[model samples]
Target: MFTVLPAAGGYTMSENTKVIARIRRLMALGTRNSNPHEAARAVALAQRLMQRHGLTPDMLSLHDIQESVCQNLTSNAEKVPAWLSSLATVVCMATGCRCWFGWHIHTSCSGVKSVRRSLHFYGFSGRAEVALYIYTVLQRQLRADTDGQIAGYRKRRILKNTLRRRADQFREGWVSGVWQVLQSFAPSECENSMLQRWLAQRHTGDTLGNVNVRAAGKCRGDRAARVAGWLAGRDTEVHQGLTGAQAQQQITAGGCTHE
Candidate 1:
């Protein structure tokens, strides 16, 4: 049995909290009993709760009684690249959060200059966490696929310029695939508007840029590589009920700990 609460702040935040709590309880029970069937049932229930309540990652933040909103900073040893920024933007949009890039300058071991890139995620705490986890997983998958494809081209004695073009093509295809998947998971219209308003309040100067895809670039890459990468991007095998430090470490280990 579950309890439903009245809506709050023009959204069903209270009701969402109760739903999420129930989901978490079910997840814990499944884990304790080591029952895969129970876990699957819990995941199904979670999906239903999310759909029925119009829940986005932002709504999950409402579960925290101490704060109405929260933010998280994930730092990497490497400088932030345009591709990473693009991926982060996609994840943020899909998870109902806002993200921006920052640099953390520090001195290296040899007293040389070093700058660590940081991705700043702002939203409800729960949403921010989920956004980061998803970002980590996607980043890992992208890098691995790109590397493997580039290596295969090199083994075939492909020209440097051609390989570069192929890499670009793979990236485009991967991004397109990820965008399609994220769109499938998009929040409800009401939740989308609320998220946009929240982002507008905090990130007044941020504006989305238009992306132009070139047909020639897509045609130049290895068709097999692009398709494989795209398929990987569409894979969504995440533990929806995981949260806090445990969830963070689980995905970050091989995913995006250092970029």
Candidate 2:
């Protein structure tokens, strides 16, 4: 996690930083293990070290310092979908982040303007990057799963009309099921407090808004599509190497925002 370099002039890594890095590395390895006993032991060791040092995960993971806001996870549409908001909620819960959907105005070289939908995240610097990575992975998986479901329904002649509505239902169900999967990973009280402070300091004047999704009407194929989507969402998995070079570089980057 934290690499030590010999002092070129007068600077050197602190002992506390070294210990936190080791703890983070251990925690990352523990979470990535397939064997339950080994994983438990690794995490336990990490926790013990943290206790001895009076350190928390936020300190070990560098979340207690350097918060940032990341944005421009574009949906490439004029109107944002309700499922995207739901997906953002799931990502926020899993990563200890906050998310909002907004629009971006862009002009082409020919002077044509367009409105594009985008997603934004606010949290510790690493949290936003992690949120972006998870969102990208899950969004791709959800789209692929929904496309497969729609194609299967077409082949079976089960979906003759209301295709858009049916797709929305499936996506909504998928987000719900994914939320169930990640519900237990919510942030700790300390981390939540830090997030609240960040929001209060950064978004003090921001307006509260909501995404409006039309309610789905009763129909025959609605249940089937939603069930399929729920099943797919349950099967979706996300594995991130938090200590990898790419992630480390991004986490330590100079820019405050990911763009």
Query: Candidate 1 regions off by >4 Å?
Result: 1-82, 180-219, 222-225, 236-259
The number of the candidate with the highest lDDT is 2
Q: How close is candidate 1 to the true structure, as a TM-score?
A: 0.48
Top of the candidates by TM-score = 2
Give candidates' CA RMSD values in order. Answer: 14.5, 14.1
Can you write out model 1's per-residue Cα lDDT over 186-258, one digit (the tens) per residue?
3445444554555444433434333222332433556865675566556533345443334444323221111
Tell me the lDDT of candidate 2. 0.62
What's model 2's TM-score? Answer: 0.57
Q: Estimate each model's TM-score.
A: 0.48, 0.57
